[model samples]
Target: MASTVCGWCGDRTHMTMVTDLYQLPEGLWPTKGYSATPDRDLPVWMAAFRCPNENCQRLSIGWAPLHRAKMGPTKDLFLREQLNWEPTQIRRPAFPDVPKEIADTASEAHACLSIGAARGAVALARAVVEATAKAKGITMHGIAPKIAAMREQDIISPLTEQTSHQIRKDGNSIAHGDIGEELMSLDDAAAILEFMDALLDEVFQRPAKLTRLSERGTQQAPGGSADGATPVQGGADFSTPH
Candidate 1:
């Protein structure tokens, strides 16, 4: 099996264990499978895996089915269920070095996603965007205005502003139950959360990385002078050995 991200450990490590495999009886489905054959011919696999992270070596189980295309040269295996046994396990999005409040809200959003609460997840994801904007001092009255302010301040690009507006609109529809707006689906909620992840990277993670690099360069620079005096500009001997 190929390496996959462990839901338990939250790591992309090589860890997969096939516990069982079986083929369903023939004529189980009235429709054709991906191979245009009967669905009963498909192979169902049950697997167990351990997280590779030393701190989180928890076990997880998954079920998947193999599929083959009829007209194309495509064969694929898709996971139907992948879950950790413990309900209280940590499940978080992969945005590192985010502020505590934003991270906490995003974690809740992810939990809601896991439980199929699409509306709740989208609401929390919208909260994450609001918190991020507030952290950056864009405390406008509403999410749309805040996003607009962020774009005005060059905190986000115009494209990102449009996307944020769309996310906020969806979240508002879920909150207010607008008749004309479509209900939030699981995929919709997940997409909003994914956008938040990328936004955090752009606003927080990348800036912090550049700051660290600058500080490191300053710290590693050679001393000013032999007597601890400030070196004059263009006065240092470039040919001298350290």
Candidate 2:
């Protein structure tokens, strides 16, 4: 009787159609008055709904038996039409705390991946590397070159050519490859994410320069103690023989 625009089509109002008792399968029809069936039957109680939109006259045709679905608040979580169909509930996730360094690496790795959804992971790794380098007073540009220089000066260890090669390869992939081309499986994505984070930790995280018990040592503590130590109480040099 009343006209209401279809949510999907926007141009046409929803219309309902009804079927005669003979039209329905014998056993499926309600035994009592034609109107005795439940609300769900009301739809089937009649014919399916059709979109009024002339251009997109989509039909809402389906076989749904009488049933009840628990509905929830329609304000924030639920859609209006959903109330007419099936009910659903919403829940929020309980997020855990993440370490700053790990968070940074993940952000960087995410930025580096062009293929698939792994871009986020790559960006995280890159962010971690860049941030850590900056904190260590290292240059962000020409990272491989900077790393090489540090290796040569014995500032960093185990800086193999492989590391540089991987960075270049990964960089090229992220920069030039089609994002949709190389969609990796969940396992592969996880592995790569782990690798990225581990690599950042391995190379970028400067180890706490062996914080010695006392600064007065025979030889400068191997990694050249960065933590400046002070003389023992009474200005007594711990290095002096008793």
Best by lDDT: 1
CA lDDT of each candidate? 0.63, 0.40
lDDT, candidate 1, 148-219, per-residue tens: 888889998777787788778878877776736455555667678777776776778767765665555454
Could you tell me which 10 consecutive residues in candidate 2 have the lowest summed lDDT? Answer: 86-95
Clashing pairs in 1: none
* TM-score versus the correct structure, for each prediction: 0.54, 0.35
Q: Write the per-residue lDDT of candidate 2 for residues 130-219, one digit (tens) a residue.
A: 454455567747656655554665554564334533544454455555456554332344455555544444444322211233434424
Which candidate gets the maximum TM-score versus the true structure? 1
Query: Compared to the true structure, candidate 1 yields what TM-score?
Result: 0.54
Which lDDT value does model 2 have at 217?
42
Weakest lDDT window of 10 consecutive positions for candidate 1: 79-88
